[model samples]
Target: MGYQFETEKVVDFILKNSVKKVLIQLPEGLKPYGVGLAKEIEEKAGVTAYVSADPCYGACDLPIQEAEILNVDLIIHYGHSEILKEAQKRIKILYVEAKSNLDIGKVVEKSLPFLKEYRNIGLVATVQHVHKLEEAKKILEKNGKKVFIGSASGLVKYDGQVLGCDCSTAEKIKDKVEVFLYIGGGIFHPLGVFYTTKKPVITVDPYTKKILNIKEIGEKFLKRRNTIIAKFSQAKNVGVLVGLKFGQSNPQLAEKICMKYLKMIRKKELEIILTKLQPNPNPKILLEQYSTPPEIAANLLYMATYSFNDIVGKTVCDLGCGSGRLAIGAAYLGAKEVVGIDLDLAAIQTAKTNSRMVGVKVEWVVGDIEVLTGKFDTVIQNPPFGVKKHGADLKFLRKALSLANTVYSIHKSGEKNRRFIEKTVTKNLCGRITTMVETNLVIPYLFNFHKKPKYRVKVDIYRIVKK
Candidate 1:
């Protein structure tokens, strides 16, 4: 009934393909329209249409095998752009971009105050708002602002479409603009600009007619990171943790050695690396466990424990602990007791292997977080973003809160979501946010189902103290 799907174009494409039967793959949000859409295609194009009800992470996850088994001639994948040209060649698939119906004028008006000062400003948006960028640009120009819109690259199929991984459009035009205007919904993609460049980044939310609290929020974000790095600088023994859950994405041996060597260059372990680069004079530990990136996890733990001093000789819990990054890092940093729990046997196995690899003592358990029932000094975790599941991350947060005096958790960043977390922590969990460290979280190429080799999202590290 609404403008989300362009059914006419879909029917036209099916008729042109001369396919007897076609398959339609919709994300969970769009599945309800399956019956109506199929009926429309069948009536208009005279081709039988079937809907794919499987879970889809992104455009990278095509239901090719299912379509092949069903013997469908074409696969109409909705809700994302193409991630790979190679997949297109191997399979008959068409990606349909589901444009939003949000009005552009209000969002443009709301953003003018931020844009009025910067005559030369760069503009970018996610796919939903890419179509309206030109309209936004016109409005800005009418008010004497010079707007620049860049083309999409890699997984971005249209002009100004920014994936979680790529924000090169803003970077490409960085030198030209005084500030960058990102037209999108959340604190997600706009953050890449903030992290990657010196320019001020502002996100114009079409839905809320609001902008991110960049000045107030960004400063708090950076100060926490500086504190964490400072804490690491003063430490006597540093642990470098690695956790790549989906695969053995440890890069090449030489690359791995380079990464290891740079983190204080443990001379005894190196074969011919002559230079020792010690950012800190601490004796570093290179521990391999499937955990969150050490850079993020260590900082998170720092925020939670209030410093390395607090973590030392303290009992800590790591939930959804993939590869024991947090637990081992804590153990290596001086935590007297560290327990790591995860549902994935492979991750637990990887964590145990990494414990032996790093020589840090930790209690590793393979089970759900609910199985444990002991009060802990602190809980450190990096849970799933739960963008798809709505409140999946909260479940982890609730479980950790029940068992710990303080909980350090990683979450996707946005004003609305942060408010929700704050409300939930205070009201539901009976905790208060002591420290907030927000930064861009890098997600490696988990699967080729994406266009880029890697991507990053704006994530928050919160330290919640139980009241």
Candidate 2:
């Protein structure tokens, strides 16, 4: 009677009915994961089984044709609460709720108070949890609440069909409701709640039978979710830091370089001082604010080579100078004063802490370089390589021209047109300049399922003094 299938009752019906063959109806959209469940049922029940090819409502509906084709006496359905009228009499439908990681009963109970507060609410969940969605919605309705179930078209059949999140369905109904109640096994089931509407979102975990903290789940969810705006922001002049040795992502390394550049910009804005932490095998590693990977000593050296610092003692500017590696290198080479800038407050703070290690006074600030103004005798920096996140190499060059007497910057060498960059800088810069091209030293590393070469670098040191 209820949405949940009682195992004993289903088994009793199957045994008593002299079921010679069994048919399993899985939602067309949920078939990929349902195939495994069907195999288990056949092995456990010792019965011949058939799976319906017919499209279904969350795997709840099956064609009467399947019963005739398989000649099965019983059919077990996965992930749907309703059966089509056509299949009702021909097939003995045993609707078993797909197991969820959350406790459904407790989730419903905990959400009663919230549901009662809103007269009308929108309900949504992922395909895996759709079986319990109707029942959950009904419970809210029974408590004097109105529920509108989102209409989600079944998954597409094409190979290229990108399975979009169910949130789009929720978005359609957002304006019609005062609040949204997401009933599913886990917070993942109701991600649509975050984007669909500004209405307060309540997530019920059917497996835990509890109402969870939506804010906590949302925060973690957003951290992993990639956005187009963020991508563009990172694409400006980002650098990704990958390890030269082993077990690292090449693309990730490129991103790290970008983060370092941004951190340098932030440091300038906040006027935070920077210090270099000890450079051991593992430098105090953390992803920059823009999601660049850890900056290793090898990366620092690569940046140094790319930075093209001329004879030391020239006042140098290190834009987005994370940990002051390039700045310190310039200082060590005899640059008079080294200035490092970054956008990350933490990196600037740590840079100040590590400045002692460099044994040099490097001025690090937390700010964006687009707004900073100053003059330096030379500018040495490793601008981000803008593969994953945007980089600010252009901004660095522009800033260098505006604030310094000469500029030396490192960037990805393999980008589409290396010559165009030289032209851009030459065109925008105030005076005569020289460019030196060099390939980024290739580093090999393992990450996830892929291994790749990391090298996209061209270092340019330009001299521009007021004519």
lDDT of 1 by residue, 42-140 (tens): 998898899887876567667777887899888888877777666666567877777877887877778788766679978888777788888888888
Instruction: Give the alpha-carbon lDDT of every model.
Output: 0.71, 0.54
Clashing residue pairs in candidate 1 (N, C-alpha, C atoms within 3 angstroms): 60-449, 165-455, 243-291, 290-322, 290-323
Clashes of each: 5, 82
TM-score of each: 0.48, 0.33
Supply the global lDDT for candidate 2: 0.54
Score residue 161 of candidate 1 by CA lDDT.
70
The 10-residue segment with the lowest total lDDT in model 2? 156-165
Per-residue lDDT over 18-104 for candidate 2, one digit per residue giving the tens place of the 0 to 100 score: 776877766544466556555655665556766666666443235455577667787777665442444556667776654454436
Best by TM-score: 1
